[model samples]
Structure formats: C-alpha cells, structure tokens
Target: MKPTRCPWRGWLMLCLVWASGSASAALPIEHWTQPNGARVYLVRSDSLPMLDVQIDVDGGSRRDPPAQAGLAAATALLLTQGVQASPAGPALDENAVVEAWADLGAQFGASAGSDRLSIQLRTLTQPDVLDAAVALASRQLAAPAWADPVWARERARLTAAWREAQTRPDTWAGRRFADAVYRSHPYGQEARPETWAAIDTAALRDFYRRHARPCDARITLVGALDRASATRVVDRLLAGWANHGCTALPAVPEVAPLTRPERVQLPFAAAQAQVLVGQPGIARDDPDFLAILVGNHILGGGGFTSRLMQELREKRGLTYGVFSQFSPGRHAGAFSVSVQTRPDQADQAVELIHSELRRFVEQGPTEQELAEAQAALVNGFALRLDSNRKLLDNVAALAWHGLPLDYLDRWTAQVGAIDRDRIVRAWQRVLHPDRLVTVVVGATP
Candidate 1:
C-alpha cells in the first residue's frame, strides 16, 4: 500500500525549519516615533515569561560641557536613584526602587558610555509584576527624586572612584590614549580631578535637563508581549515625559590629520609598558563600516588567526596578547592598537606593530583569510541576537545611530560579499601610516 500524501504537513514542516534557521534575521520589530517625543522600538516575543526594556538617551560623555567632562555620566547615574514621597504610593527612593524590583524578581540598572546613557530593566511578564515594575520605573524617569542627600552620596562615591582610577595603569592608559588620538575633539577630553571635585547638585540638575531630555530618548522593548500590549504599557508609562528645550549632542568638530606622530609617556612603576597607537577612524554611519570590520578581523581582531596575533605572540613572543579596535563616534573616533609588554621589549613591539600595519594596509587580507573571517563573522552573527538583552542592545544601537532597521538582516550578506580588493581599498582610504599616533607608557627611554 502507498503512504498517504500529506503535502500540507510537509510544507508546514519546511516552514518551521526555515523559521528556526532564520531566527536572527526575521526578528520582527515595531519601531515608531512616540507622541511624547521619544523614539520607541519594540519587538514582541512570547518565547519566555519575561520582558526586557531599555531606554537610551542621546547624551553621554560626548554631550558634556567641555569644562565638565564627567557631568553627562554623573547625570545618568543620578536618574535611577531619585524618588517622590506620595501619601498614596510607597516611598520611591533608590533603595525602595531596588527592593521593589527585587520583590518582583526584576533587574534594573543604568550604564553611561561615550555616546549614550541607557536604563535597562528585565521583569516577569505576569500582569501584576510588570505593571508594578513599570509604574515604579516611570516614577523615577518622569519625575526624578533629585534628593540632595542622594546627590551628595553619589558624587562622593564617583569622585572617589575617579581618584582611585588614576592609580591604575590601564585606566590611565585609556585616558591618555583618548587624549592623544582625539586631541581637541570632545571625545578626547578626560575627566579632570578638578571637574569631579567641582561637580555639585546644581551642576547635576542642569546637565540632566540639558542632556537627558525626553525628545532625545529612545526606548526599546523586547520579548513576552504582543505589540499592542507593549505599546499600551510603554506609552502609558512614558506619556508624561515632556522634553524641555535643551540641546543634547552638539556638532562634533572635525578631526584633522596629525602633523606628526604623538608619543606621550607617563612614568609608572610596572612590569609592562602599555602602548596605544592609531589615528582617526570612520564614523558610526560610515558607508565602509562592513568593509573595515571584515578587514580588521583578518588584521588584528581575529584572536589567534589574526596577523598581529600570529606575529606578535606566536612567532616573536613579544607579549601575551595585542588587540585592535575602531571606536566609531558621531565624528571620527579612534582606531587603536594596544598592547602591554616588558619595558625592554616595548620598542621592538611598536616596530613590529607598525610593520604589520603598513603591510596589512598595502596587501590587505589574503583570499583564504578573508573567507575564514567572513565565515567566522557570518556564522557567529546569530549569537549577537541570541537573547532579549542582546537583541535589545542591537535595536537600541540602530535607533541611536540612525542605522537602517534591516542592518542586522543584511550583515552576513554584506560581510560575505566583501572581497580582498574591497577591504584593501577601504584600508587605503582609512589607514594613514604617516599620521598614526604612537603612545607608549612605561617604555624604556
């Protein structure tokens, strides 16, 4: 007897397999401009019993007043710590906020990076739990506590941390590297000890109003709800957020080619010298971003397979590990190669780096290397969106950078299409050997 022909079920099975395979690319996103001036990005997923929401303000160290390098960061730190005393509801201080989230099995935190400040929350999808979490979170965001006591404590704590960071070689190296590469650009400004000392409650209030305005905020919600429900919950919570007239991100000045290499050394008693080198890199929205990203992987970003790693670690044994990065900002940010090595080997390492950098720029990656890199990046793309938090982060990044909504969908294709010649041309345009700044701390004189 012949088996029954069930083509309909076979088709359904095929679709299911395809959907599972295209999980990362087919991420359904509902993005829109909110009525209250915030840009919101939402993705509904009932896969798990929780929801993740992140709010990004287009204000970070980049928006700080030139004189107050730490103000923008300080402002973000204070937003989640405020509370209002209402006879109707519970006390909403920072401690109360923490306890309420804990009681609901939710997590809440804030982070300030170079270009933005983000507040993240993860809570159970249960109606009561989500509702309470949203209400508590909104109180702090819509109407901040701005308590004098909270300001004093947070300021003292931050100031102490800043002062203590000076003692750390890595921290100091980072600050120095930024200063060397960015120069007059706002991205280069270091948080002065005096700036932290000067920061007061008044400064914090003004900075928050100017930088963290409602219009500059982008909200991203992912996981555990339908679009309509997510919209209602988010809109209801943030509807009252009004944008006061205050400019956030200012025009970033153009970065000029360095007339000569800049080498600034800070004497520190350590076993290894920390070195940083490179010049101005591409902007966040640069058209050649994919080309550069793929090329970078073959040069130094690909751990053991990287040219720099193979030469510096495996062949010469100069140091344990050396890494490269491109920190793209509103304007061109730093493209840096950094390593730490014995004081005696610092000079040798720097020459090897320069040699590899020059050769990479001239020859680019081989076909085999490019193919391997493309495979590595393309294969690993799914991991970038494996979880709610990771997906939320990518969505927020797209919203913040004004990238195409389908950027992630096209990422693998873009990487795979980049040939050796295209990457080489991209490097030729970006990497300038003559102008690269070389900075080494604790190198032998």
Candidate 2:
C-alpha cells in the first residue's frame, strides 16, 4: 500500500495558522494630516471601552536655545501647569484636575525626552469624560502660562534636584559619561545649578515659540472608538492650533569614540561603586536595528540569560545586577551598561564587562542563544497590543520613528527571519568595548 498525499490537510493547517495569527495582529493604522499641519495616527478598536491619546511635539531638551540649557524641559513642564481661561488660572493647578480625573477613573500626564515632548491621556470611552479631557489637554498645550513666579519656583525645585543628584555616585557617573561622550553637543550639556538659575519666564516662552509649532508635532489616537467619532474629538481639541511653519533645528554634532577610560569620583561614604560604560551607538533608522537589538539581548539586555549577567553576576558575583541597553533618539543615542558593586570589586566588574563585550564582538552568541532570544522576542510581541494604552504607545513609537503603517504586521516575521550570523555582524559593528567611555564613581583602581 502506498501513502496518500493529503493536499486538503496542508491547506487546512495553513488557514488555521493564519486565523490564529490574525487574531492578535495590530489594528489597521489610518494616517492623516490635520488642517493645522499636525500628523495623526488613528487605530480604532472596539475590544475595550477605553481610549489612549498622545500628542508629541518636537520640543525636547535638544531644542533648548544656546545658554538656556533647561529651557525646553521647563517649557514642557509648564504646559500642564496653567492654560489661558482655565479654572486653575495660569500656573495651572494640577492637583484639582488630577483628583477630578482620578475620581472619574482616568489618567493624564506629560513627559519630555531627548527629541520630543509628549502629552498623554487615558480615559474611559465615555462621551462626557473624553470630551472634557480632550478639551482640557488641548487648551493646556496651546496656551500655557509662562508666569515669572511659576518659572522661578519650578527652577528652584529643579535646581535643587540636580544638586541632589550630583551628590550620588550613580547619577554622577551617568552625567559624566554623557558629558564625555557628547562633548560640546547639546547632549553633553547638563542641567547645572547655573543653567537652572538662568531659566526665566521669557526664556521658556521663547523656547516654546521656536520649537512647539503645529507642523513639528504628531498626534496618535488608539482605543475603542470609530474613525468618525475619533476624528470629531481630535478636531474639537486640536483644530484651532495654528501652524507657524517649521522651525530650524540645530545640526547634530558628530560624535567621536572615546579614546580612554575616564572616571569621576563622588566623595560619598558608600560601600558600592556605580559604573556606566559604552559609547555612541547607531541611529534609530539603521538597517541593522533588529539585529543589534537581538544581539544586545544576548549580550546584556536579557536578564539572566545574557552574557553580562552570566559573567558578572553568576561567575564572579561581582554585582547583584548588570544590563546594557541602546537608547534611540532623533540622532544616535548611547549604548550603556550600568552596574553597582562593592568598592573593591569595581575594577574586576568593569574588566569582566569589557571582556564579555569583546568576546561577543569577536564571536557572537551560539545558535541556541540566538534561537532563544528570537523566541522570547517573538512570543512576547503579542503583549504589546494587549490594551489600548499599549497599542497607542506602539503607534506613537511608529510615528516618532517614521516607520511604515505595516510595521506591526511585519514585526514578528522580521524577528523570525533574523539569523545568528546577522546578529553577530551587528554586534561587532555596534558594540566597541575598547572605544567605550567608562564612568566609575566612588571606586578607585
């Protein structure tokens, strides 16, 4: 008897796999430009009665004007403090509004990063609450009061915080590492005591004017709402924003690799030393991004399975924990590994870290290691779309990175296709232990 070929069986298996994968795929992305010049990303889902909206403006710390180191950050913070014609009355009183939102089971906050300032809101998909939240956030973004007294108080608070950070070894090490790596670039400048003191209301307003133009912003909307209704809400909130044309961004300085290890010491009576090492890394849009990400996971990014953890913690017991990560921005960001250990073990820990980095560069992770990393990355991807808030974060990242609408759909396939050889090449190209700018505070060799 000869075995029979089952064509229908293969077809049925294919359909079943497709259906299972489709159920977890990201919602279709609809991109449109608002009349005011702000870009919007809308993803409609009826799975949950919640909505998440994020408005991103290209007005982060990098946009600060010369000699106004903290101006951009301060401007972003003040946007939520007070708006024109609001009950909070300039220097916007957030306590009352925050409490009110909490009562309504909603949340709102703002954050500023190296490349953008974002205002985010999450609320139940109820009409009245959503309408109010949208209106209030728009008003706050459009007409923030840069009052002198408010600016003065915030400056004092931020300055004190910076001063306090300077006294800590970990903070000092990170700051010095940034300074050494970026040199004269905007990334190098720290929010120092003098810089904070010089931040006045006029400076904040001027910085906002230069960077917070509608044309330079992008809005992302995700949640359980139809396109028509979401458009209406967005129009009501942001339609009034006027585009003042694009602002000229300063050219990013070319970063050079560090020549030797530099150390900064904080004279604190502590038993442990804080260390940060590595240098300027690839940009966000690099073609080898996925490969680098996977490689880093094997090197230091993955918790217990990574080379850094295995060598530093498991083998030598030099540090309780150690990890490395790549931070992507508009320009190239840092690749850093941070660790804390006893003062006497600092040099040994640093040596082990460098050794592992060099070994990974010379000979990458094994087939088993690469397969494990890929599996982890692929299997965990579904969690990214588990909620409206998480979905909105993914969309916001896509908008920020200028990725295509189909990025989410292709993500898993891309990760699956990455091979061990590609990861090895990416590791060698990006991770240079010898050229790293090392910062170790509170321990001496």
Q: Give the TM-score (vs. native) of candidate 1.
A: 0.90
Which residue pairs in model 1 clash with each other?
Answer: 45-224
**Lowest lDDT block of 10, candidate 1:** 14-23
Q: Candidate 1, residues 1-445: lDDT per residue as tens digits?
A: 8554332334333433333323254777788876667787887776665678888886778777777878777777777785666543755778877666656666677777878878887776777777877877776666667778887787688778888987867787787777777777778877766776677778877766666566777888887788778778777666546677645556756776567777777777789899888988988888899899998888889888899999999998988999888888767888999899998888889889899999999998888999999999999889887766677888888888888888888888888999988898989999987777887778656
Candidate 2 has its poorest 10 consecutive residues by lDDT at 15-24
Which numbered prediction scores highest in TM-score against the true structure? 1
User: Which segments of model 2 are wrong by more than 4 Å?
Assistant: 1-24, 86-105, 259-268
Instruction: Give lDDT per model, in order.
Output: 0.78, 0.75
What tens digits encode model 2's per-residue C-alpha lDDT throughout 1-102? 744532333433343333332323557899988666778898886655567789888877776655778777787777666555654344345565555454
Residue 295 of model 1 has an lDDT of 87
Query: Model 1, stretches more than 4 Å misplaced?
Result: 1-23, 86-90, 245-249
